[model samples]
Target: MNKYTIRKMRKSEVEIALNWAAKEGWNPGLNDAQIFYDADPEGFFVGEYEGEIVAVGSAVCYDENYAFCGLYIVAPEHRGKGFGLALTKARLAYCEDRNIGIDGVLENVEVYQSVGYKPYYMNHRFTVLAKRNRAKNPFVREFKESDLQEVLSYDRQCFPAARQHFLRSWIYQENARVLLYFERDLLLGYAVRRKCVEGYKVGPLFADNEEIAKEIFLAIQDDIEGQKIILDVPGNNLPAMNLVKDFAMEEIFATMRMYQRDLPAISHEKIFAITTFELG
Candidate 1:
């Protein structure tokens, strides 16, 4: 048997890592690894044995208080061995603090729990109305540099800290559409959507009311071209919950956002959707 070694994932290896994620049925967004690495290049990693990569994952230490670890995958042929656990433990060690979080599949919760990981909370991904037949909202537009201060101010009210690096990388270009909601010259909310594995996903959906949230959804629907759309909504937010129901989106899967620490204090009142179970 060849000895296995763990190392930082190269930019070229992102495809391999993503393929592993796909086999796990994670349904990652398109260019996701790019966006993520662009945010923090050192976070992603992989395990290689001989000439083949046997396992992969990431430890995105956005900062001291909130670090996230996910994208864990091991080849099916190597499942029974200790490769998975070893790779995971190595990834965990990369995190600087105890605030490590992850959105684990139900099947492997116990496996993760065995090694210091714990249950945090459950999350859901819903399929919303397709925009093939009707026009989407006109308010939604591409993100621009001018919107920086506005987005920063908007993000502060929602998340605990200013994830400027993550936000900037995710909203890198005009393609990563960041929609804003306005009424009488006031910035009430914002939403972000991008292409991923299955189709388009709008995450971190933030809005002051159901109406604004609904409007942002409509705007995204217009661009999807009948493709499937996915969004993970927090179980506690009823307004955002009802808004998805209003649009006739179907709940496809329920996932638990597991964490070694308590869930951070986020503004559920204005948050209609979270960016992703893995990152946030």
Candidate 2:
């Protein structure tokens, strides 16, 4: 029998986990390591066997009531062993009874369900070549430091819990651009575009309505024109589905959004895109 050591991962070791994710064709953002580490330095965990790290996972507690689990990966040569399960247990234990969420692939849905996770909905990842839209909305503007409070307030309507620290790191990370739509001093929505391993990804695209969502989405693509753009949207949001179809984006991937408890009651309609599978 092989003994596996499971424990919290150091900040610097996060890159190793992300590299494994990229090798699995997950297309992680280039600066994800720093941003994710900043989200919760104590949330990431690793499993080692005979002094060699072989698996990784994360269970980020956004608040006392909510946590998210993801980035679960085992080295290709280390799969089929119990290392992955050990890492998963370690992360779950760290979450400590909080309502934990995860975006998992379909093939593992049953595996997750067996461990007390229930599928809530599907999140589809769509991709398209960015094309500049000449329509410019005056209300859409670059995000400023002063807008952080209002942005975080608006974010809570779509997300499950307060993630001020994570949002701060996500918006200001290198190779990322944050944009917000404001009208009459009211924060309507915001969006983030970041460079990924392959191209770029726009996420956490929140808006009061489809028009506002479209505005932020198109505006964020201004500088990244001609690059591949990715968006992960909830299956239940019909408006979000229509918005992506209007852009002629192709569905490239999908994940089952599962939770260990009841789903959080938030404004799902406002969420045009989720942050990321590995972090949400």
Candidate 3:
């Protein structure tokens, strides 16, 4: 008998899964565990085999209408025994009645599709050596606590779902750099840069045009000079593709964005870069 049991993961267990993710070359953020936990405490799940944890997954529900599944991994020694599918189904069941989404690796696309997920677009991860540039935008300024409401409002326009809880932690986390673009009292765009295992990542980069995106991106590099910077851009956004190419960034990774239901209406024109694959 296959004595494998699936259950919600404890807070500490999330860290273990993150370690597993790093070992798998995912390069997760340093404080991602706590932030991910806060997003949905009951979202993370693990499979125990003979009382030894062997598989993990997450079904983080952002709200009643939307959820995201990620971090699905089975122990190397436990692969080829249906553990991955078991964990995946557990996550799917958790997000019952909500539109579930995932940033799936290329190899898992068919597996995800077999279970109702349909590919919508691709997210290409790019990296470049951070160089100090004098690019300056007068409207760009450090994000302040007072800007939370406006930031949320602006972000809602760019993303399909509202993730205020995740955004709050992401913006306020230690060693994170967040910048906002405002013109004549109107918020135009924003970008967040955070330290990662390999270097730093800039994401959730929303802008009205390539110039605004470039200015904010370069400003972030200026703050953390000499470190490699990574950004994951939507494959369909031609201007975003051009933006990275202009900076001489190299494509390092890619994932297909899939959803279990009809794709939600999001302003891809404003989304120069996605927030994070694991959570969105």
Candidate 4:
């Protein structure tokens, strides 16, 4: 009989893991497979038992100093067999010597902590039905090729690491919309809304302040009125919490942003919404 083994997943195998993520109710973006694969082709991994895949995880190393771990899952029948633990260890080893981040579910918080991951803050997922908004700000416009550098520059201010490749594909993905808040030569913020398994999700809603964030949020939903909208708010940002409460968005899920080392220094208030819990 073949023994269990761990190996790096191929690009096509990434989608198979994403399918399992969808079945687990993660609501990943429809175009996430390619974008994720492009982020770090060598980041995704899988565990096979007796020649059959049974577990998966990711340890995307954005740069030498920073990495994110996520998309961890084990087939229901394979739980408690140590396959998941082996996969986790493999991912950790792949990301060693870097500050690793993960949005771990609350139930697994302690489990992660025991492995040297420290909880930094809570991220709450909120959902609401889109509504028509007559407000239109001339400063807000659809992303264009000319705006790539400016967007990346501003995005770096909000995100912890530089992920130009990931951001490039994320903005141009099919069935998605990327909007920017610019005033004259100043690129204040930007947002991306993508179709998910159920409805739509607005993320990486980085802004200079709460007002700009609100405008971009409502603007993204203007055309998708009445459709389900989801946003993951960081608990550390009071304005982000207030923004969701102002819309009466229902809280559906939550996770702890944990790290294996020192957390990267970033503009906490400017990160209105995280890009993705899976890849941080």
- Give the alpha-carbon lDDT of every model: 0.78, 0.91, 0.90, 0.91
Of 1 and 3, the candidate ranking higher by TM-score: 3
Give candidate 2 misplaced runs (Cα > 4 Å).
none
Comparing candidate 1 with candidate 4, which one achieves the higher lDDT? 4
Residue 142 displacement in candidate 2 (angstroms): 1.0
TM for every model, in the order presented, reads 0.89, 0.97, 0.97, 0.97
Where model 3 places Cα greater than 4 Å from the true spot, the runs are none
279: Cα error in model 2, Å? 1.4
Clashing pairs in 1: 29-196, 30-196, 204-274, 204-275
Query: How displaced is residue 166 in candidate 3, in Å?
Result: 1.4
Model 4 error, position 199 (Å): 0.7
Model 2, span 197-265: residue lDDT tens:
999999989999999999999899978789999999999899999999999999999999999999899
